[model samples]
Target: MEFIDFFILAFSAVFLFLWWRTCFTKTKPKNLPPGPPGWPLVGNLFQVFLQRRHFIFLIPDLRKKYGPMFTMQMGQRTLVIITSPQLIHEALIQKGSAFASRPPDSPIRLVFSVGKCAVNSAEYGPLWRTLRRNFVTELMSPLRIKQCSWIREWAMENHMKRLQIENFEQGCVDVMEICRFTVCSILVCICFGAKLPETWIKDIDGVTKEVMLMTSPQLPDFLPILTPLFCKQMKKAKELRKRQLECLVPLIKNRRAYVEKGENPDSSMVSPVGAAYVDSLFGLEVPGRGHLNEEELVTLCSELFVAGIDTSTSVLQWAFLELVLNQEIQEKLYEEILEIVGKNGLITEDTVEKMSYLNAVVKETLRVHSPAHFTLAHAATEETELGGYKIPTNVNVEFYIEWMTEDPSLWKDPDVFRPERFLDGDGVNVDLTGTKGALKMLPFGAGRRTCPGLALGVLHVNLMLARMVQAFKWVPKPNEIPDPTETFAFTVVMKNPLKAVILPR
Candidate 1:
């Protein structure tokens, strides 16, 4: 009722409005995808960060409220999540060049990737193109794949031996651990051209796992001021890097020495596989980039090592779990394998190709449990329109591969484990490449930046699965069926590691 009281109230209201505008309200120039509103200073940061494990679950609800294409603000960054296959096709395929470049890495990622020299995180330009081309031509080409067949056979045999030991000693084997060890051993052979002792294989595996856990997106990544508070993680990352370098440097040095001495690097391996991946790198001459230095070489090898082991292991783990759950499907696959390669006959790279049911099972596994829920985030090179929404240059975009593949409209009984979908009926002869038109499924991503390791990954999965099935009958342990509950590692992984009984057929 007094003049001073009225004046004080007005002042308070004006101050509150100014604070809200400055901290909470994000200015929009024109058209941006619709999303949930947030509190002052921290927009959707806590909401998304706290529920990252169930982040994919939130998308469907968000899509229902804000359409297929929507935006979310994480601190200062704007993330555009694309759920529809059509929109994904538009951005990643039709307008791929406009969206191919990766965004700048978070501080943690930069440290892990060794200044972003790794192929996956490298920016789109001469450097990226050069590195990618080298990877494809020297390491992942069809000829190279065939040349690496000996490595595959040796690795598969070693895997079987390890599995047999585990099954004998424990009666129930941890499929996830043995699978990871086998893949890591194979990767070490491919990368370094040697059959490392089990201890060294494990040492490398531990380093890779640490890096994956450390480089995973964290709150400090979104809010840099909090990075100091997360000093433990940063220190751990540095230590992992040091351990990684220690594991890899010797191999690189030895290969370099072999090259200098004019000796064949492949001679060091258990089986000669033409040139090892490291040997190829030694000879690679990237245009404008020249020869890769020691640190760069270590970083690239680390990328390949982790990418190869993690993705394949995750897929195979899911494959085995699916087989354990669906015994009939497993029977069908084993029968098909028997028909293709007689019981006593060896299953080689060529033999595995002829087995259609095996291929279908692997395809189905990828469709149902795509290892990566999201591709590494891509940034628009310039202003673009996706799904009729304006996307500004440098806006971070992620294609929802898992969501697209599992869309009810795209495939029947999408939730059910049905390899037969790829074999016959409505889903018959589906193309996984997305090159035919829109991608029905993209476990390895799609477009120019599609995983360079696609061929290698498929070969590894098929061979591992086929051999395991042929060698043993796998079943869930008593009261311990393999649970398919998913968790986020660098890849989508089993929260509960698969435990199964293996019996010699």
Candidate 2:
């Protein structure tokens, strides 16, 4: 009887120890940030997924409850949201190398990126560096941008002519749609070295939007085990890829053939002194990955077009919306443009720099209506401390650009649309790069992964806005006020498309 008692006691002790280890020791991290309590196995997925209409809207309330930096578990993935600009500077700029890599993509994103072949989604390594370097030196450099100035001018002319036609025919033009068409035309010209017909541009734009929608987070992304149940999404992704290839492959191949023959293509949009972006890609040879194949080339070009068109269009649309709402601000901008470039003068690259108020208007628009709510997710390469909180290796860190830009702590009257704030104050010398100090705003992001298209994007916005305000007077339609309510597509866009009357000045 004593022997049986001893065995029972030992077995009970062992079971208790195992239970404690599994339930307590292994469940929580030692120094994780404070966040809302979540359910077993799912974490905060349900709470987050429920707010899918505008998930970004929840951040402010979360910030109020959890403080500046906090954590949320999305199934098995840990997400750390950093809202403080100082902390953002520390993580994305000070310890940039530590958080330079990207987390694994959702299944649909994997397919859309063509196994991460495009520069934006490519892993941070030799391939990404090579691709980004190629883009900066060969395409986005000041000299290169100057070379491509005519493309923007030509695109603007087309945009103005179309606006006039639409205004005459319809009385009020859908500014959002016209902006998309104009931006896409410019990107198409740069990407393929030719001004494609409207039909081809519309086809590419349609496929691009479809692919972006499909790539948004789905059930299978958080629970990979459920991928088999999401085969329909996979099929749609493949179909989108096929449609994109059908439209893009022919252009890429034709450009490649032209370069291969050692003959400069007779395209009006191609720069006389340098190769087109597609031609530059044909010459690129990564360290491990050899020269890009046809499909890879197509993917890269498609990414360029989509990235350039979407965010710039959104920004320009917001600029117009704001200007129409605040006619006084619009008139001030018009006065500045007239003083610098004159009523009938062309707004060239050189002239754009001379328009300080125009620059301020663009800066203010970026601050108030940032195109993206979050920067592309950056993953910690190893366990580290951020804002004095422990961040585990492979954890996703997202910087909320909209929140940072509008943080009342940083800017005075952040909600108000005031361009003069950027003109005569501390913001007068605010640097977008965040190199000199803490970033006041990151419209193009900051650090090693800063957007390679910053100069081009800014130039496009400045010139387009200058010409539009100079060419016509923008007024809200009768009994219809311009609503700046935002909705998140791939880019955050105005919930209602901006529709207004454009009277030629």
lDDT for each residue of candidate 2 in 212-317, tens digit (9 for 90 to 100): 7888878777656557556888998888888888988877776666656545455533543245788788878976779888888887888877678888888899
Q: What does candidate 1's lDDT look like per residue over 1-505, in tens digits?
A: 6989876876566546646665577475368888898755557878876775467657777888987888887765678988788888888889989888888788878886766787899888878888898788867777877777887778788888889888889988887788888888877777777777789889889888888888877777665545655789888788877888898898788767665664555455443434678777876786666788887898998888778888998999899999998899999999998899878789988998899899999998888888887877888888888777888875678777777777888888789888888778456767666767656887777777889988888888899999999988989998875678888788888999898998788
What overall lDDT goes with each candidate model? 0.81, 0.82
lDDT of 2 at 234: 90
> Which residues of candidate 1, in runs, are more than 4 Å off?
1-29, 50-53, 262-274, 287-289
TM-score, candidate number 1:
0.92
Q: What is the lDDT of residue 426 in candidate 2?
A: 47
Model 2 TM-score relative to the real fold: 0.92
